[model samples]
Target: MYELKTKETDDSVIEFIERVENLKKREDAYRLLDIFTETTGHEAKMWGPSIIGFGSYHYVYKTGHEGEAPLVGFSPRKAKISLYFATGDPEREQLLESFGKHTSGKACVYINKVLDIDVEVLKDLIRQSVTFLQELYPKEQR
Candidate 1:
């Protein structure tokens, strides 16, 4: 297992938020983090270099790909904030339609600012995504 180097990491989650050049973006990120953890009943951890992640699931596909990953996470990218979902369910695509100003990658939703989206709506989306993952994968496998 790879240990988290929290102390030595300059971009620790807290410090990263503090460094956000935009105030609204910073506040929104923090709010989403709180809501995501509460709704999913999971704690958040810093994944890889910058993603703030909550919950985790282990996945092995028919192609022989297998790995454990966060069920939900976000990166405060330079151009926009990117929300990640490992599963690309159709319902999630529908959610993005009404999710306010955003664009989508295969499994990432990109948002420029929190003000561009409804906070409550975002929370609901997160809840739905986690629920979808749990249903698709067994508890042990997830």
Candidate 2:
């Protein structure tokens, strides 16, 4: 069986943010914590050693691999802040057009800071990601 390395842990989300060595990144982490919490209406949780996640959902792949994952989350890494969202949400591409400065991968969006993006658009992305994941892996199925 394959183990999920980034499962939720009983770590302190605040302490993790406080420990971010970069002052700017630390401040951005705090701002993101507030924004994600307010938008998701869910408290933050430590996901593995780094990620600060909100609500969670269980996902089972077609291959029978399954795991729990946060509906949305972010990590203030050394290079940039990585925002986690649903990978298959079509609206994500559309919204990112107006999202200010950011780069993205299949499942994560990278931003330097909150001030560089439109916060309203950020909120929309957060809501869409949560809705997308929740619908894909419905709570009743979890």
Residues 11-114 of candidate 2: C-alpha lDDT, one tens digit per residue: 99999999999999999999999999999999999999999999999999999999999999999999999999999878999999999999999889999988
Clashing pairs in 2: none
Once model 2 is optimally superposed onto the true structure by TM-score, how far is the C-alpha of residue 24 displaced, in angstroms?
0.9
TM-score of each: 0.82, 0.98
Residue pairs with backbone atoms closer than 3 Å in model 1 (clashes)? none
Predictions in order: lDDT: 0.76, 0.95
**Ten contiguous residues minimizing lDDT sum, candidate 2:** 133-142
The superposed Cα distance between candidate 1 and the true structure at residue 11, in angstroms, equals 8.4
Structural RMSD, model 1: 4.1
Candidate 2 stretches with Cα past 4 Å from truth are none
Per-residue lDDT of candidate 1, residues 73-117 (tens digit): 887777899998755677777777788998888878899978889
